[model samples]
Target: MDLKSSTVLITGGSSGIGLEIAKQLLEKGAKVIVTGRDRAKLDEAKAKHPKLEVIQSDVADSKQVETLKQAITSKYPETNIVINNAGIMRKINMHENRALEDVTREIEINLMGPVRMTQAFLPHLKTKPEAAIVNVSSGLAFVPFAISPVYSATKAGLHSFTQALRIQLKGTNVRAIELAPPGTDTPLFTGDEFTKEDTAGPKPMPVDELARAFVRGLERDVEEIRPGVSNGLKWLSRIAPDFAVNMLGKSAQNMRH
Candidate 1:
């Protein structure tokens, strides 16, 4: 879909990929609204990009998402695009003793958040002649990461849900797209456990490059946009599923402290 002159809402737009996408959309002359849970970070992002409309809302909170939906629809009824980019990833040892609620946090934020947001915005999006829903998944969705099993599972679930949503939306004005990104240079991977030595090989693609790839994919109407190593993971999973899973398992084992 043409991005220029369109209104777009991006969750988790305070930093990383979401922020990059917001910047690009603004440059493209689109009305951009960004949401983040942290008020300070949202303010910082707004300060950096004066054109950005920042909203403080936690995707994991149902009430907050409902409020966000009502606020956005009331203020920008013409909003035609929703980017489900809010998510959290944590490296956890399943064998370790941890609170049950703590262990499933990724599932709630990464998986359920998009589902909730989509349900809240689908009707509004359908009202527009042209609309899109971009769900940000991960390469780990194709192959499990043993160190972050919960995170991987959540991404996999998201991928599945996006596929189903796309099919269900057939013949509708709304379009569903999934962006599966490879390992990237973001704060999410800044922990000591994710040192350079832990990476399988070369460094990840630049965040800016990945964001550009996303826009290109969307413009081309690609259903799944797998940038960088993500494409390799998808192919490898098909050609050698067991081997790919084993490889990731080995990498996680080495990284575990």
Candidate 2:
């Protein structure tokens, strides 16, 4: 709740939405540490924001998660917030012959990464006076994006996990918060995998705005922060699930043709 006093660790903070959040949190006077798999990107992020403490750690690897927990607990024991924002999205044509390991890559990082990170650091967080675990899911979680099936499923899974986690930690110091962001103008969204036609609907929310929403939600103690179209997606899914699916499935139709 008190951003100025809290020390936050964000996974995949090198760029995109994660980097924006790190920047905003730093501006708010929060001690921020960011992790990413790429050393060069981490260095670049550090160069841009001298205040950010960057660590090269891949969230997909269980071993790396354990090492990260040890490193953080030893060096920055005051870390009371963990933001699981590390994720990858790919446009996979499932009809093509792909390796089994390749198809499920998003699951490891987007879903299981948070699960492991929470299990590893929850005890440490619980010992603190106050703490929070912010899981960055997506609007796709509310309604499946057929174009990026694996990525969509992972976010959906994360949404479910965060809800259960919030209930389990009902009387604890740590709060489970789910940040379901809509399509954002990030490298991840505009990457090589997605073409212009694939994301031709509403303009993606700016990454900085999403980060601001995250801070505001945290300050207000909002358990679920759905910014921009994400809020609409959730309600639409409830009101007209089939229509929501058909609307999003248009991209898949384009891919098929």
Best by lDDT: 2
What is the C-alpha lDDT profile of model 1 across 1-257, one tens digit per residue? Answer: 88996999999999899999999989988999999989999999999999999999999999999999999999988899999998888778766788998999998899999999999999999899999999999999999988788999999999999999999999998999999999877777654656555566657778899999998898888999999899999999999999999988876775433
Candidate 2 local accuracy as lDDT?
0.95
Residue 202 lDDT, candidate 2, scale 0-100: 87
Model 2 agreement with the true structure over 154-214: per-residue lDDT tens digits: 9999999999999999999999999999999899997787999888898999899999999
The lDDT, on a scale of 0 to 1, for candidate 1 is 0.90
Where model 2 places Cα greater than 4 Å from the true spot, the runs are 254-257
Error of 2 at 118 (Å): 0.5
Worst 10 residues of 1 by lDDT: 190-199
RMSD in angstroms, candidate 1?
1.5
User: Could you tell me how far off, in angstroms, the CA of residue 255 lies in candidate 1 after the best superposition?
Assistant: 7.9
